[model samples]
Target: MVSFKFIHTADLHLDSQFKGISGLSDGIRSFLRESTFTSLDRLVELAVSEQVDFMVISGDVYDAQDSSLQAQLRFYEALDRLGKHGIGVYVIHGNHDPLDSPRMKTGKREHVHVFGPEFEQVTAYRRQDQRAAAVIGGISYPTAKVIENTSLRFQRDKDNSLFHIALLHANIDGDPAHETYSPCTQQDLIASGYDYWALGHIHKRQILHELPHIVYPGNIQGRSIRETGVKGCYVVQVAEDGGVNMRFHDLDTVRWFHETIPIDSIAGEEAFQTQVEERMQEISRECPGKMSIVRFVLTGRGSLHEKLEEGRIAVELLHELHRRAIRSASEPSGLAGLVWVESFDVRSGPWIDREALLKEDSFLGELLRYGQQAREDMTTRAEVLRSALNPLMANRELRMLLNETDDEECAGWLRRAEEMAVLLLAGEGGGESTDED
Candidate 1:
């Protein structure tokens, strides 16, 4: 029986979409971009601390057409640390880091083995005293497009060749959410006869199978709101009796969180603050030391809707929380040390400008009725409402045709389109003439 462990992670995406770092301070943004290395360093630290036999990086080491020299050097430096500790490293290029790219170069290391585009059958043995070892077979993305399933390429292990593990970077059977690169199915993976499958490409952590374990470790850190929450890798422990237990290890340098707090009876900003604090308190307890940048969405209907819908309140709240935390030195150290509120979108059912709406025959009331009627006029409301507000659509004939619309059923149609048009006009400049400008 051989008792050993390994770390699995993918999609590091070093230096991805750096242009959007404008909101962060120059130093902080630079740190965040370079923090991919920091996450990897944490992985290395974990490996050494745990005395893991090896580490496997599935793919996407960098997110660019060309990997930077600094990136390469930094990667090797981390690997060099692992080497000193006698930990082995195995890497395979995925869709983002294809084998044919000039950005990636093959190098030799006593503690490292990188699979090529072709199936490379290899085995990692337990320390010399152990009687058995695990066999791993894998391939890399040759070019960008791998239309056929790559699982068919993996050959079953020879008799008595130890536990078989297959590593590859591709989507398994058309996940619409992921890029269609080297699409293979779970059935294909099971049929391949590998004891385990280490996958990459999808940023979300998922387990596709358990019979012969198939898993994606997810990205090491959340890059944006799209890739939210506590990011990390997996720690796989293979027991002496051959039972494999996988645990997720949070290795992110920064944290991204999205939370929806229901405001059924919120009275004011104090209520909002209380709700937000309660949510943050819970997240802090759950994620501990993660630098939680949050989107505290106030959901449901309540009296506090109008105030929240106003300008910059969410940003102000986030900034204030961050300031308060820093000033009082009351932050949770387990987090990565930043709390930014990304956005506060309003979805409450409360009506805006209620007092104006109660005033009969008032402009606000008339507009409200018009909106409700327009929305209800499912048939011609879209076009009629568009023509009504858009001065550019002010062909006198069309406006007259639109103005003739008087049915109360058309309220919903007008409301929806008018609201959309209001937003469009506000951003692009009001009316058809301004749109042309």
Candidate 2:
């Protein structure tokens, strides 16, 4: 019964630029730029503190086409720290950091072993006895577009006595959000007969399988609002009985949060503002000792909806929220108690009985019927819209923006469209009594 422990992490994306983030304060922007490095530093600190047998970084170590010298140096320094502590490091380059990319002049330490473009194996040892603890097999992406099923290439070691772990940066079964690089499936991984599969290339942490422990520790830090919540790695311990235990450790210096505040019941401008402040305070308590970027969605029917719809009110509310965040940051604790509102969306509708509006034989009813039809036949409508918009999206710049627009963005646009239709139709003076005037 050989027991050993190791840290599994990937998608460091060092020095990566954040997307969809603009008009931030200079201090926050600088903090965001340094977040990746800070996350990697914490990972190294964790590794050293845990004194694990070895650390395996599945891929995407850095995020530039030409790897920045600062990122490379910072990475090397962190590895050197692990080397100093006699902890071994195993790494494979993902799409962001391909094998052909410009190499760093400062060489890696002896304890560090980077898998090459082809499938390779490295035997990690128990630090004290130098006994073979685990056999790690992995392959680095030679270029960014290696769409082959690299997982099938992995062959289990003949010596079944030592624990076998496979490291890869791949999109399993084609996740639409990510590029299909080194594509493979769960069956492919399971059939490979590896004791553990440490996966990368996906920003969200997931456990694809549990029997053999196929896992993605996710990126070390969230770069955008899309990558929300706590981002970190996993510490996996293999027991003497061949059972595997894994635990997640949060390493993000700054967190991203998306919160929805239902303002349906709240009345009056002052009360609404107070509610917003209370929500911010609640988030501040939840994410204590961490700076958070929050996207607050104000939803549900309420009297304040019309007030919020006014451009000036929204602007004033945003300003107030910003001031609150700045004031919190200026406290003795600094950024730790901060909660910056990256954006606020007013999605509330007028406090009208929607069912009664639909029952009326008026323009509002017709509009509601059209909306219902569109939703009921969503697939067909989506296809029609996609076909119509294909020409516009064909332009490179337009395509880039379209690509950045996730499902949430598309939904938001649809919601706004619906609201606009409702507002226009409901304004008709001839409509029968749908609600109080």
Q: Write down the TM-score for model 1.
A: 0.74
Q: What would the TM-scores of all predictions be?
A: 0.74, 0.92
Q: On residues 1-437, what C-alpha lDDT tens digit does candidate 1 reach at each position?
A: 47777788889876665322234444455556766777878888888888777788888887657477777777888889988977777888887777776664647787788898788887675543434467778888887777778889987865744677788888887876678888889999988888778888998899989978999889987886667766788999887667899989888877777788877777878778888877777776665555556666566656665466564656678677756655433333423444555656554545344344435454444554665655566555666755656883458887676565444324534444454444444334232232232
Q: Over 4 Å off in model 2, which ranges?
A: 327-332, 356-363, 369-378, 387-396, 429-437
Q: Compute the lDDT of residue 202 as modeled in candidate 1.
A: 92
lDDT, residue 349, model 2 = 76
lDDT of 1 at 244: 91
lDDT of 2 by residue, 1-437 (tens): 47888999999988888876665667777877888888988998898788788899999898756378898889888988888888999999999888888876665478999899889888899776777888899999998789899999998877567889999999998898888999888999989889899999999999999888889999999988889999999998888877999989999988888888787888887887787778878988998878888888889987777777776776887887787666656567678858887877877777667888778777677666666665567674577458656898869998898877765566566666677667655565434654554
Per-residue lDDT value at 166 in model 1: 83
Model 1, residue 84: displacement in angstroms?
1.8
